[model samples]
Target chain A: MSIPVLTPNIAAALAADVYDTIEMPAGAEFTPATGVLKTFFDFSRQGGAIHGRSGGLLFRRDSGFAVIGKGKSLTPYANSIAIAFRGTQTGYDWLSNTNTRTVTIENQTQAHKGFYELFKSMRPAMEQQLNPLLRNNAHAIVHCAGHSLGGALAQLAAIWIKKFYGNKVALYTFGAPRVGLKNFALQAPGSVDATYRCIHGDDPVPLAPVWPYYHAPYNGQVVRLTADTGIRVSSHKMRKVPHCYQNSARGDWANLISRERLQRQVFLKREDHHKVTFSEYWMNQIWDALTTLLRQSGGASAFVFGLQGLGAGVHSFYDNLAIELEKSGMNQQHSVHLEGLLACMLAFAGKRVIRAIELTARFIRWVFRQVLSVLDRAVRQAIQQVK
Target chain B: MWHLQRSTLVCILVGLLALFTHNPAEAGMFGWFKRIDVQVSPEIKGAITLHDKPQADMVIKRGTFFEDSWSWDSTRTDADGHFYFAEKTVKAREVLHERQVAVRLLALDYPTKGDEDLFFRLSSSHNLKSRSSDLLTDGMHCELSAEYTMSYLKSLEYPNMDWHGFQSKCRFLHADKVIVSQAELDAAELEETWRGIHSLLAYITQNASEMDTDDFIRFHVRSSAESGLAMLHKIRELETDIDKLNTLPNFEKKFQHYLNKLNKEDQR
Candidate 1:
């Protein structure tokens, strides 16, 4: 029942295959086996159907997926598999609730726990689906990735997976809150090797009820990513994009992935890559496949529409044009039709009374300028005549 | 002519339909904005409070929810660490209907602490009401007052033996100060007291490390000027630490120089 380790080649092959099949419109790239792997789950305009909820909560669940890989393997085949979950955004209501049962709170805390429960309950079903591809394979590594609420669920799922499989599971989460008591981390087997929790700078979620993680004996890595967004906007001008994801994808996640990659390069030894085995590699692929299916079926689609509308609404003209151009490249006929329709509408509008008014205003200003110049010349000529 | 007119009417109707379909809520011509002022400073001596205002404001559409409001204006503190809010008139008439609105300030110094000789007072214009009081405490809105004494003896920097001895002495002193016969500070209250003392001591230690010897002396002198008898005694005790610096050969010259300069200024 021990988790299997994955070699670099096997991990890379699985990652490459998953990326090929997964359709993420945001152009988010995945770099795997380099200590960190990033796959964007675009769940923008799926009508918030991914989590069976909409509105603020839709943003909470929109951008999340799981990561699966092997722990420190003796031979990549013998190493344990690990999984970690990300937490919710800093100040959002759904993430603030930590109690198990229906407590005095705003959003449902149990929804994420419920999602983890569903994932765990369906592990056998997932194993059944995955076994044919990975039966002879080594142990499986699993991780859940999320920014805000997803981070929390990733942590919860890792714990549940460990409890179910016993000593084979580990959790690596980012910006996750304390889901349970201080003992929760202790209860985790291979917790030291398997769990890593990273937090970006001044992310309010990690600081809220900050004592638990501060006092806990959890041996997970905590990374502080940059908090300052270079672009400044008044809080009033800020409109809440449908999901809690930032309108511009220029925040903690981007900083985190970059930092995590750098840290891996600096700290991880090259020998670690050679330790992975074929079975461990195949198991990682199965885990990667599960992540892909989960993200593709709901996550990525939601993000695409979410990002599209956000770009459109924010008057981020460049982003909107870029998105449209990208779409055009993907499907030429549809893009051409859209462009033609837009052009026709603009032409008609220009010919109307509103456009005429603007044209008249411009003409008046031009005529006034010309008349003033003529008057100045006449005055000079009059002076010459008098002389 | 009749056919042209009919076509024109049809086009107008279609355009109107499109406009309605595209955006249901028309954008407003005028925007409403609000201003908020928050002030937080240490109640300690020489912590100057200036009247030079710093304006902080949040803007919103007239009918939008208060929670959805945005910060339109934020001002930095002045030379004396004081902020002001200039009188701002929101242009939108729709937002003015609400009365008795709650303003939440992210004050840095929400809680203040002091020693037995000195007291700390926190006052706010917002008239915060305590959850514990109902009828008897009418004007006594959420005003938190705490008195305490701090010493570096209990800090981790001190030896364990010294810390134990110092803490025991503090406990005994704390017990002796109970004015009411039956009243005793609970474990929770004592723990809180320890935290406050620890925090103040930590702050002093940090400041002491960064400041020059002359600046340190000046700080103690200022404290002495503002303090009552009990605080003056505490200041004298702190001055002794400054005096002990004279024992270190490297520190002695600088210490003597600072003292002589202060004495010359006093004579003048």
Candidate 2:
């Protein structure tokens, strides 16, 4: 018999249950909750090895867990295997989330440094538990689901499961941050059989690791619910709040809004660039503008150029971008917009420099560094909540 | 020889006096003297209630901040469900800084209980120089049924601060009438509107359609009309919310005109 297909609502419930297992006591059995019928593999014993010590006054219990279970009849998919990963639960986890450094993976793809580290830590245990279940049932479908940071890990797991086990894999993530860069995001359609990326309009998690990093099912449609006008930290929460992913993920998937082609941003005027406030719409436009300038400067290779090699990092990449924008005499509009963008960054940092005079390339780079540092602090505080 | 001996004795006396008075806590050799300092928390007078009734004999736990650590104290409420704590002071060498003090009334655990079930929780800073009012010192009447109200603390000394995590379940009797924020009002209204939309969409599909010999051909047309009607109703319900905001589109009027046009088209 064929395996039962999963719906968006069921997938969201499974993802929320992953948090319960994370908080479960060590050596406890994986109890059947949403869709899971029988406990196939519970890596709760390896919980100690993966647990991180508390740092300073934060008093955090840093741990990550994944469970593999057989789906129940009522929930459907008796022949299916359900896997779920929990989101960031501790100070160390938040620390990892904020580490936006990139690392190159296979196929020249790059992923967020912290998320990759978390995936690597849990991969061995996941492989040990999943290898046999997958090998035994050649026809069994693997369903992976998670929320928040766990959503990013679920995406990575989908890629690995599809490649290694060569099984049919379905991936579902809610309010997940961008897991990797362009190449990594592009790899999704080829790896996973189906992808349901559910998100809230105001959710800040899905909007970040900003520019270079991208959400999977790249350029594909998303299940968008609750149309809040701007980005909100509270929207990143899964439960017990308004506009939360859990609350918004209700009802039939077909009834919900799904736009195949997302909204396009207009050209950034130099005069209005400095007026750009901290919002999802403006931030997306600024990121897109930067990406366009990079592509124009040296094709797609420009993105990967300064990202690698000695003394290379995100700072160097921005420095290179600033230099490109300064020297691009072919389009004076782009250069002027870049200057205005720098002024906006300065203004965001409480040092408003709205002069129309042309700024030095070095000064623009300096402004980028300052603004990023402020953003880093803001993210650190925001992560303590739902994001 | 007598003059040289007298000068050497005078120098030795001066050296002895300097060594006796030397202080390591001072900034430099000639630095000003440092003194012991004391900081006091604001006086607290509050009452705790559960389900609108006075909850007497409940343990009220107060955590007073002293430097990096907290000093905790516990007291039971009186028969009338009132609790009181005098001003708490802590002494330290050199200088003392004012800090936050929190109080919570713990509910007896019965299988499953959480922070939300607590009779009261309030946190406030003791430094009056920073803010003119104190939540604890004012007449506080806390009800367990009340939802936690969060407030942001902005300091003139530190501009650009946007922290908004402070929360309290108690009402200050001395305070002015509570002012609701526009953002909060909008969020509540939006939630209700979306909920209504969800139900209306479900109703349209379930009730407004008919099955023909083949399939429901008029399903789209009927659903569209129902959706428009729902939109008009939702807009009318929330019209007052956008009355003052001129930037917002007049969707209620637009939908009314569109529905009338649809009715005209049907007649034609």
Candidate 3:
């Protein structure tokens, strides 16, 4: 059977569920009565993406789970009890789960290693916090979502919940890497459920665990969030939060007009065409220049090329142009638009370049500090020889 | 001593770049609309071979960038085991794009031995150049490598059905009119639109069990409204499997007919 596509509105709602958990402080306590993001009868928060730990925080509100992010709407996934996962966090990024990329699982019969490992880490937390909630809301559909590694964990977790509870599980992962082999995705018990992996304009996490390891073996549908930084694709791992960016990723995808109200009218009447904006042209121009610089005959060029090979597929840069756009209000188009989509993608590419620059600057400073003493001694030794 | 050649330095800088890389945990996604022309021509004149023998045929299964893989087009080798097929993809055109294709090495071994259909996946194979033209040539080469190990049934099968592609095209040929699923009664939330769709849905649902699959496909598909109401009726009346809906005979011709009817209705 063909899988249904999750509209941007539905994805936005699920993003809230995951975002609430990611943004909530590590020490915060959650209960259905005191949910972190939504205020329902049974709202609460749990889990964290600790460095050595496998689990990340998840928020629950009544049958639905959420985390702290700028989510304004909630009706799309109303009946579904959901959990969101964070892609990676500072320091403990390695612990979330790592892909072996061999396309084979250790048990052979079981799921892949990365998924299995992540499930092992998250099981304890979910058993304590989420299992009971699942028990109480047995009638509710299980919804799991995350961006990047959190997405892989969600795939594993959904499989487990479906197995343990015999309930319908829906998965929505964004920019998620390949969790297991194609067979694992194809034949895994609940792999054919209502799963979606939303991708933004060239966000590279979805391309990970490379070659042979595929992201869509589960046959989970793909949704494209064409909105730029005005919509939050990188907020999970974006580092410039200190730069004062408001309106979280969830907030960006959430429709200002609710789905239920809009459902009463024409919803998908205009499937607009994407226009090639100036920002997109500018991005290519910049790419050409950077490639020129990196293509010069040198080991550094090859190394940089290798480094770029890791994640750089066109719009792979790191910067806070999202903040600048937000501040300028140029990024604010509450609904998905053809023009806005182009603009968002253009700005996103620009921001990536900026991020690369910022990271390079910090590295250069550290390298200078380390080499200063060594250079001084070498100069003195040379002078003594000359005397 | 640092071998500080420009290339070496560039490599060093690149390695350093990895340390600062952070996961963009929070992500945004989009569903792309694509129209591509897929052309398959062997690098040499011969068909792909296994164990030194020329393989008999191949099947090309088209899949979206993410979800359910469907057979878009297929071609079999000639007597010399050399074949080429090119097509403009309108398969699942009503659906979103961002698609990829899988080439299955069809071995016409007697009784089709142990290892079924071997599929070599070509990722991001089709890059549609324009929306206006479906003839956007995407040069996709299928390199049959020894690494591809998993096997599958060459064709998707249903209980009383031929191959999915065959059944779909055949039904399209035999039927006078065709109905494709596009219009949603559920989406018709306006009072008049909703009432129209709801009544149609209810009428179709109530009496569907007594209807015949062949008769329903032939008769209801040409409904006056030209909506997918008749197709829905066919499903309800015949208790037809959803997967069997599109596997009609002469699918492209019927699809174009359905589109033409939809266009004509809109004009009215």
Which candidate has the highest DockQ of all?
Answer: 2
lDDT over C-alpha atoms for residue A127 of model 3: 62
State how far residue B95 of model 1 sits from its true place (Å). 24
Q: How accurate is candidate 3 locally (lDDT)?
A: 0.35
Q: Report the lDDT tens digits of candidate 1 across residue range A1-387.
A: 112222221222222212111111122332231111211121111211112121243342222233333322112122223232222212233332221211111111222333344244334433333343234432343433333344455555554444444334334433344443334444443432244344433233443221122211244344433344211111100001111122222222223332221111111121222332212122232223322322332332343334311112211322333343333332344333333322222222221112221212233233223322222222222111111
Position B191, candidate 1: lDDT: 29
For each candidate in the order shown, give its overall lDDT on alpha carbons. Answer: 0.28, 0.54, 0.35
> In candidate 1 chain A, what residue range of length 10 has the lowest lDDT sum?
A230-239
Best by lDDT: 2
Docking class for candidate 3: incorrect
Rate residue B230 of model 3 by lDDT.
32
DockQ scores of all models, one per candidate? 0.01, 0.02, 0.01
- Expressed as tens digits, the lDDT of each residue in A164-207 for candidate 3 is 77656677776566665445655654443666556554443454
Candidate 2, which segments miss by more than 4 Å at Cα? Answer: A1-4, A25-27, A32-64, A73-75, A92-98, A106-108, A260-266, A298-313, A327-333, A344-353, A374-378, A385-387, B1-268
> Residue A118 deviation, candidate 2, in Å?
1.3
Docking quality of model 2: it rates as incorrect
Which is the leading candidate under TM-score?
Answer: 2
